[model samples]
Target: MNGLLKKQFGLVLMLMLLAMLMYACAPDEAPVDEGGSSDEEESSSDEGSSEDSSNEGSSDGEISGELEIQYFVGGYGDSWWKEVISDFEEEYPDVSVTEHAGPNINEEMRSRWVSGDPPDVVYIDGAGSSETQMVEDDQLMNLTEWAEGIELEDGSSLVDSFIAEPSTYDGELYSLPLVFDAWGTWYDMNRFEENGYEVPKGFESFMSTMGEIQENEDIEPFVTTGQHPYYFSRGMLYPAFAAHGGNELLADIVQGAEGAWETEEAEEIMSNVEEMVDAGYVDSGLGALNHTQSQMNFLLGDNAFIPVGFWLPNEMEGDKPEDLQYGFIPSPMNPEDEPMAIVPDLRPLAIAEEAENPEAAKAFVEFVFTREYAELFSEHTGAIMNLEGVDLANNENVPEYLIQANEMINDPEQVEIFYKPHPMSADLETPISDSLVSLLLGNITAEEFIQEAEEAAAEYREGQE
Candidate 1:
């Protein structure tokens, strides 16, 4: 895989780690903290202008300036960003958007942020750049006032339209999550229909389906990016943990709570995957395949399932099998459990606090978060925007899989978690990944995998102290 099509295994790894950690400890229901805002006040669509930042320019609402923007250009391509920019600039004809985007954007923007020459706004989603670090260093502007004070075209407060809490410091939003997706398993819907196979609704049925596929046909039932097992963490292994203990057990282990990692739960979790492998459901050749290869294997009808994110269709746009009806279902880690979606805290676009053009940066934020742009984002990328009222069902161009995911995520009955519980440390990524690899490869049992990860977590926590 190369060019705009190549998969960034590392990005997948980071996101999965987050999926594993963040929500493990998340509250059952995290309402936007009202600090000083009241229920009657919040229920009103129009917020008083008190939150308008003192730094906001007196523009008479005519947004015009040079806005510098950068975004990641990977499988989730930059066409949507460019389209939004064009619309923004057309609306403000006097404005010019300078875009510096690509797969390497995070690295490219590094020196600029260091030299205090970063762009006015950056779409900080992909592999690099840390929104938390940037926030801690005071490099990004706080959107508290504007986000709360400004009314959208619909009269809704800008922040009120999102499912996200205005995760703020001193009522300030350091970053907002604009785009959201969960890693999941996809199958050939047509194949399932033809074979009389029901889409698995729970992990038990999912595993049984895998066994049935192998038992009833020569085709392999499952194939993942064997070279990148973390792909399994989201729709696969994490669901297993969620299955047995719900997020409570997961929270204990991931949050570094006392005596958390040292448990039989780890052993139990590994058994889920082990039983599948023992059932001969996993492809033997999986170890040699990369993400694209394995994905193609499923698309070509050589395999029945591939675990991937919502980006799979776009990434394989050119190579996808003709007339193939792709189908997706969240990993049914536990069949009897209620609906759940693996949401992660990948950061969104934010203005640099040191932005030379603060006004333009704010305008850019406003432009992209609108209903029109959110719809366009979903139509173009097949992923839902985290912003409120941006439903895939509203866009006919959106794929069925995305629409399904959008509905599942927003279903009030379902629980969503912003994943990525990488040990709250700087150095645990590799070692933890190594432990997962060991567990998957059978080089280490589940107990061993948990021990190694716990050891790494211990080292990370100590360093934090």
Candidate 2:
């Protein structure tokens, strides 16, 4: 079997076993008889479900009732959710918490979101559903005032608790960013060092270096997950945004300003991609490879580099190279200056505006930043939380690669920072990804790619009107 299929089959089987195991050892706690009717009892048969454990006390009434929590079960998993919910239950004895999580948790929650019966708290990650779209549609809560003066046990407001405050649009806070996904070009340091390859810093020099390496060694310099070509575009797009014009250009493109995608600055970015394709640096088999196959091929020396996230180590934990020596570099955007690393802020947690239990959702969000919750997050997920001053270096559960990545980005002297996202509408993301993929596969020209994207953006704006 192919690498991706093998891995997927294993995951499916594992999840099946996990379901059976959990069922055998599952706790059957009766619902808390809250005098009134219990919403918790009714939601137990949900698509992704965990029963709200029966709890004592609760007359304090700070924030009571069922907290409908929806979260993505991706690389981070759902263990952290269970840990934090237990903490929330302890803190607010009157409240009942349940877990509703799956790989497609966000997709499953869509009908509820539209019907104004959304979960109190939702993890705003993954594709299809977007926090930005939700904000534009006026379906999200404005957390501005709540953020300014939330009381924490440490006597600091919630605004002061984070390393960086959540992203805002129009001076209104609508979502809270929790998880950090660092994207870049990944390589094997041992192979590079052994082969005496100096990391190239500029786009022109990087292309030259790839040419020289191809001439001298058996190394195939670049490969992208071909079946999912978006993986290649995902990392480089941000640096390209910064190189062309940064936020000013990003705003124009996102707002669907006329001719924004056709500018010379934008062309510079796509042309570089074309140059790579023309030089034959891209893998021929790139069109057939899935993410797992590509990563495995990368490790096996079939290719020298791949575009991936910090979650690489976790994903390939068992299959990683011995003496790993992993290294990362930003996609070179310009010929002269050192390329800026693309560190997009991710908002994984948000409270719905029209939640059945809004106060409880806000309380749950506030409770997430506390020391207990942060440590549990690191311990289970190994993701670098935005909560500052939590030293997780000694935590056994924290992956070593994550610790290295955390230190690399936190030190400002390392490289320039590109702080913006794609800023394109949700509808355009896939089309643009496809366009880039097509360019690499020799099916489309760079100009043709941009034209296709611009056409899609125009359609999106017209529908918005």
Candidate 3:
């Protein structure tokens, strides 16, 4: 009996040993690979994400929608615009850009808006009736909301400059600044140098230079249009105001603050224009001539200086000789102040409120904001991009002096938004642009002009209330 029990115990021990061996040999739990290998997988995933982001830069050459864009016939039909639109259509096969061009864009827009079929986007140059009216009637869409939350590839915010601020009302953006056609004087460098005269800096210096020209040379020192009547005010009056104390004085006047207009500063500005006319520094033909003819006279060397802006270059395209050394300078003022000033007005692109293709309109606006388009538009317009990182080259038409003038205006301290904030009136602009003309023509005394301007401003302020 003892022998049989011992044998049974040995058999049980053997079975236990075999089970232990099997457990030891069973794959040793395969020592699972730790996070070190997983790092490779993570890197691959990151690279894929980076590639996806790169693909999203400025949208691929793929667009498929029907688009209708309306531009001023004056600036349309350029090679760059043609190429851009063609490329856009090729990318977006389904999209079509049908341009409606005419001399009376405002009339066309007004009719279209009344007919309830306004184009997807309409351009405004401060000439299209009233921007405030459009906003109040809800005929224009608020662009602020559309522009928000959209970021460029480098994650920069889109267009922080308030080029459209004056047009904004009640803290809402109604339009986007398509082009900033700032105003200044165009000079003939060769004529100035030949006459042994330097471009004047301030009011005193400017008049002295003109006086020298008057005494030594037979050419009129400055020539501008009188019928349009706004040129002198913009090129002469506003810049003078800026030289005195920047936009503060004009702002006070527009806002009807204490002692705004009728100040010595305002009188000085009027006197400057009057003195030019009285001294025969302005063309004798100025009172009867229109803007085009005035510009033509300058191109023909009958005049030495013109009060104009960037569009002058384009308008004189064929008329101006290739070697004509044209230059632009800021309106001369007192040297005690900033050397130059910028009058910020916008040529805006607004989406109609009742647009049928709101999505497409938004898409087109984004396309316009793209760097590629901005660069082309800047070069073609003979203007620089308000947006950064754009490629630009100054031609002979845009002389070095003009480029310097542009730079000075772009300087932060010298730039000011023209017109008053929300409570301001377009009616005020009419008077300022008109009264200065009357002052130049000697029809109204400087005192009378200021008084009339004050009254007009008061009426506008009351209406705003």
Candidate 4:
């Protein structure tokens, strides 16, 4: 009886051991919920759902919305915009981007702006887009607080990375300058080399070099668009003003101060221009040509030099001769001992005051200002971004001239940068552009130019009142 009882106990122990082994090897069942479904069953159902998985990896795991972006497609084109937007969408997978972009996008979107339903982000450039006007209309959000502390991908402060600060009104930032453009003189290095012409550094050398070009080459010495006289007024005249009397004179002139246009510095610069016209250095037929025509003429070697922006090469890219090596120099209006002055034409990026997707808009703004994007910008547009520390020299795609120009622009010893406190009003710029045309054509003397400008400025101020 004792042997039989021992055998029973052994059998019971073996059965219990087998049961535990089977339980450990088998998959555990999830606890049932009140809805008659287990957690694992619900997870399996959701695994096949495309909608539920779409928000994965979104910004903060929550930034899902439609982001509307407006950009001007000019010399820079829309390639950069398209690529950046694609990259942005990938980073924020749940966000859908709608682009309002084209050469005439600014005008096409004007009604929306007027209706107070502007795009979340706007690239303030091309025709019909003015940063100052937008700010005056209270259309842009104040980016001061957010921009001040925002960190870039490399951990640098966003504001600190800008080559130039965002324009501020009463210490409040509204727009961020995205494109860093400066008006300067452009030439063909290959032509210069073939002709043995030295690049001018100052006023005296400029005259001498132009004289050589006129006497030797079949081309005119210099050419600018008389139809768009601001090419001369802003490119040459503004830089000359800054070089002559520093940024103070430029500020005064831009502000339309009473005698700003009538200053000795202004008179001297205008006289120098008049001298160039009198010497036959300027193209007499320029008045008949628009901006592109004038630029094309320069490319055809009809002129040795032209006053324009860095956008020149890109604007005329398709028409450029394969051998046309680009060369750039600041206006060279300064004295030999003085550094060349740069009057930057900054194109800003802003968020609308009523942006429905402010978070996404802010994220887009921050994404664009990185060093990586700056390099990409140079590659796509052959132009510089406003972001600092971009190494374009090592970029094989960028033209040699642009690389050299960037070096000169960033070197304090080589250039002195300045800007108008604000963009000149159309009322003021129109008269100035018109007078500049007259002055360059030798139809008006420097004195008359100053007097007319002062009168027009006074009239504008009175009208403003």
- Tens digit of lDDT per residue, candidate 4, span 1-465? 999999999999999999999999999887999999799756654452346543222333345567899999878877888889999999976577889999889999999999998899999986566776787679999998888878877898888888877777767889888998888999889888887989988888898999999999755688999887877877898899999988789977876788888888988988888889898998988888888899999999899889988788888899999999989999978887888989998888899998877887888888788888889988988888998888888889997788999889879898889877766666677888888888877889888988999998898778667
| Per-residue lDDT of model 2, residues 1-465, tens digit only | 599999999999999999999998989765666575355544532311233322211233346667788887765667778877887899976677866788788778888888887887888765456777787777778888877777556676656776555667777888877875667887788877887887766677778778877877766688888776656655676667665677667666656676878988888888888888888888877888877788888877777778877656666767877976777776666555654555454655777888767777878888886766777777777566767777778877776666776776677665555555333556666666677778988789889998987887787778778
Q: For each candidate, what TM-score against the reference?
A: 0.76, 0.79, 0.76, 0.84
Q: Candidate 3 on 297-416: residue-level lDDT in tens?
A: 888877777878677776667898665787776677545354555565456677888875565566666666656666666556665444665434334444354366556665666544
Looking at candidate 2, the ten consecutive residues that score lowest on lDDT are 47-56
Backbone clashes in candidate 4 total 0
Task: Between candidates 3 and 4, name the one with more favorable lDDT.
Answer: 4
Once fitted onto the true fold, the runs of candidate 3 whose alpha carbons sit more than 4 angstroms away are: 1-66, 75-80, 126-133, 161-167, 253-259, 335-338, 393-426
Q: How well does candidate 4 match the true structure in TM-score terms?
A: 0.84
Cand. 2 TM to true fold:
0.79
Q: Residues 316-422, candidate 1, lDDT per residue (tens digit)? A: 89998787987876666654465644634344778888875677787778777777777887788887676776656756798888877666766657645544432
Q: In lDDT terms, which candidate is top?
A: 4
- Determine which window of 10 residues in candidate 4 has minimal summed lDDT: 53-62
Cα-based RMSD of the predictions, in order? 21.4, 18.4, 12.6, 9.1
Task: Estimate every model's Cα lDDT from 0 to 1.
Answer: 0.69, 0.72, 0.65, 0.84
Q: The CA-based lDDT of model 1 is what? A: 0.69
